[model samples]
Target: MRSKAAVRARCLSYTGCVGILVLSCFLISSCGNRRIVDHIKLIQSAGYDLDGKRVRSTILIGDYTEKEKTNIKILSTESVSSMDTMQRQNTKSNQSLHTGQMRLVLFGKQFAKQGIGSVLDRLFHDQFISSRLRLAVSGTNAAGLLSSTVNTHDTLFIMNMVEQNEEWGNLPKLNLQTSLYNYYGAGRDLFLPYLILEGGTVKIDGIALFKDDKFATNVDIRDAFVLKLLTENSRNGSILMPLKESDALPDDYILMRSIASKRTIQLVSQEPAPVILIKIKMKVSVREKPEYIRFETKEDISALERKLAAYLVKKAEDFISLCKSKQVDPIGLGDFMRSKSRGWNEKDFQASYPSLKAKIRIDLKIVQSSLSQ
Candidate 1:
């Protein structure tokens, strides 16, 4: 019963409603796209340093399209805190500085030696910074660590090397997230593996140990290898063990495809010069039998085990000696003491740790022999 004019009017109103609805949806989606800022260069590596009153942050910008290319941009601002510096950076940068993809956070040797607790507290509090990002101590300035280049087999090269090492477990991977956990956790000392660029390759020179907030000392590769075996459960790796005169090897021996490890700690006396008992268990497979020894008996295996036990005991003692000399509780001896004996003050606990006597016992059991004559 509707007339042509009325029907036309109704049709027009329906069409208008449909158009309005479509426009609303388009507006919402367009707003989403508007918020997304492109051309923001991704930062792969970052270095931080303290300059008088403010902190200087250096970021490495990489061209994703051309994997071979990289550029270093320095962002400096005088602010009361790290967050303030970041806010200032946002105003100057054309592209938003996103830290979701950050891989390496390098601390200058000077800053590390002094103390990193304050700086690290700020880093861990950031919402954008990943907890799992790799952390390293630079032998030189942090800026040098970010800017230095290493040429290697791959096209992407150095960046690829870092990624591969982290993924394959060939090297110790310590990140900001793991560092914070170890730092705050009681009875656990934190350690970061140091990286130094040398002869076109990045080498894991040693480990940097921390006592409270300061750098304790640099443990060499030999000590680090043993530490790795002791702390971690996985033991599939290679190491070079010194050959003794009575052993079968010529001058020195190299162990390949071997796994070594052991860990045991005990609380001895409570008063009158408190003592702690530490036990270590290790097992190594013979990869290459040295020319100095002729073997084919059970006695050989037992003798090798004994030799390995003695070697481990000596190494453990050496490490303990080094720790004692530094007056650094890198082994979490303080934590063990606190756990065993409650109602202990931090100040008094630290004071007592210097003279704490540690008795270490090492036991080596030969599990398998890979050498075939």
Candidate 2:
């Protein structure tokens, strides 16, 4: 038999060996569990297109290891859903597809018009997908637009285009969070930036208005700009109001710069139908004008401001008329009424919606003249 000291030492050695074995096993298990980012394909942008019973999904994956590379690998597949497409794509690809880097998700026009309830639900349920991803509606097929060689890589290209516009362009800041709210919230709807392929280039065509999840109609960028001004507290955009070409004028238009704008929507009365009043105050400057107009004279300035006010009132009325005709409210009129009135619900709002009358008042403040036409 061994001495007591020797026996103790032997027991310690055995315990040490066991500990080392356990540590090694734990490390190997952890290594297998964690995903290696470098090995996986990072999806930067993706588009969803629907063709009857099938869904066509296209994604842009860039080689992260490659520096300054423009061309990206495009992976596309047709399946029942976006998640199904991903599973199928993974089978075809050696690298696992990752969506942590996805910034934009676009829907083809047809897909949008068909309604995106089920698709959006799937996306919301996806644990790996970011809900903050920007949304847009493509005037053309989303897959075709993503596959086009307009830019070496359309992911970064499209992201930059949309981001820059949100900053300086005439668009309200809209993302997945706001979109979800609009969709689920009563008396509200979602509007996404509209994109189209123009002359071998992708361009912002207009705004796609959605009544619930289904596409209602599209307003070109010009009208959308005005809509934003009316809804948002302050915005920047330019509108060229045509001054009829006459013998005295060298140019036939007055380019008005939108320095700032303020709008107030009031629920005036519920008599007969909901009577709403919209008050718009605009601060503008003359960016360009016909040579015939005199900027130095106060009378002339007042006349120009009046002209702007009158034009805007008519424009606003026309916009509201269009909304009524389409039976779609992109202006959030329902929400406004709901907030102000008691006992207002979907049924009540629907009854009053058809005969909803609106009065628009516009006050234009001309600030400065950029140049003498």
Candidate 3:
């Protein structure tokens, strides 16, 4: 029989050996899967355009020679499907193309109108693709925008532009994950940021409304600001309001900047048809107002707030009317109704959507002022 100390020593040796074996296997597996950043082409951005019956896909990849410097490579190919287009592009690339680091994907107006359901589905199913990828619709052609010589120095130019607008400008917050949720989930249609190239420069033009993955129409950035107000809380979003004559302002225009906002949707009366009353309470600051109008008194401020409220209500109603006319539900009113009502039928709602009554009420409060003297 072995002594107790000797047996314990043998057991400890065995455990150490097993641990070393497992660590060695892990290291080997990790090495096998290791990808050299310099050798692989990481796609930074991609775009899809409709080219007659086929699809024209453009991919932007950045080649880094050192830590800070990068060279952008643009490639274009045409195929029946986006997947096939990518496969064809890979053949032309010197190194293996990877999408793990992809930041944005753009769809041309024509391509988006044709329907991006299948293409979006393919992206959602990809294991390496990020859910937070930014997706947008080009006001013109996506291929043209991607292949443009403008902003070639920075591969993330378009992405950063869109991001900044969403953060401080009038654009809404959106990403692939949120888009996919709205697209796949019931009661709401998908909407994307719309980009247009003006004077060889890319700019956020508006918001594109979608009807079942097909582009329906677009609203200008001002209207997009209104849409953002209805859907979510907005901060630092500015809009130029046309002041009414009754407001007693010398100038017809005043720029109101949203400091914060909160909205409530009430489903009023579900019989026959559903009526929605959307109430928005926004805290705002005057970015630019008529020099004659002094906000020193509470009554003066109250009058200005009332004027802003009336303008906002009119704008919101007009926008809702536009959505109803186009048969698009970017506001997700149906979803809100569905949450309130039991046994909601999408078909029934859609049928009555055009005639569905909605009322907008805005309560604007002036929290600060930075008027031009």
Query: How many steric overlaps are in each model, in order?
Result: 3, 0, 0
Query: Clash pairs of candidate 3?
Result: none
Which candidate achieves the best TM-score against the true structure?
3
lDDT score at residue 323, model 1, on the 0-100 scale: 78
Clashes of 2: 0
Model 3: how far is 363 from its true place, Å? 1.6
lDDT of 3 by residue, 1-373 (tens): 9999999999999999999999999888887556789788999899999989889999898867767877788988889877688789999999988999898999999999999998889889998999889999999999778766335667777888888999999888898898998898888999999999888878889999999999999999999999999989777789998766467444778888999999899988887878899999999988877766787788998999998899889899999999999989998998988899899989988999988889999988998655333
lDDT of 2 by residue, 126-197 (tens): 787777788899998998777774366555677777767766676766777777777777887778889999
- Candidate 1 structure, TM-score to reference: 0.76
Give candidate 2 regions above 4 Å deviation: 1-32, 245-250, 369-373
The TM-score-based order of candidates, best leading, equals 3, 2, 1
**lDDT of predicted model 3:** 0.88
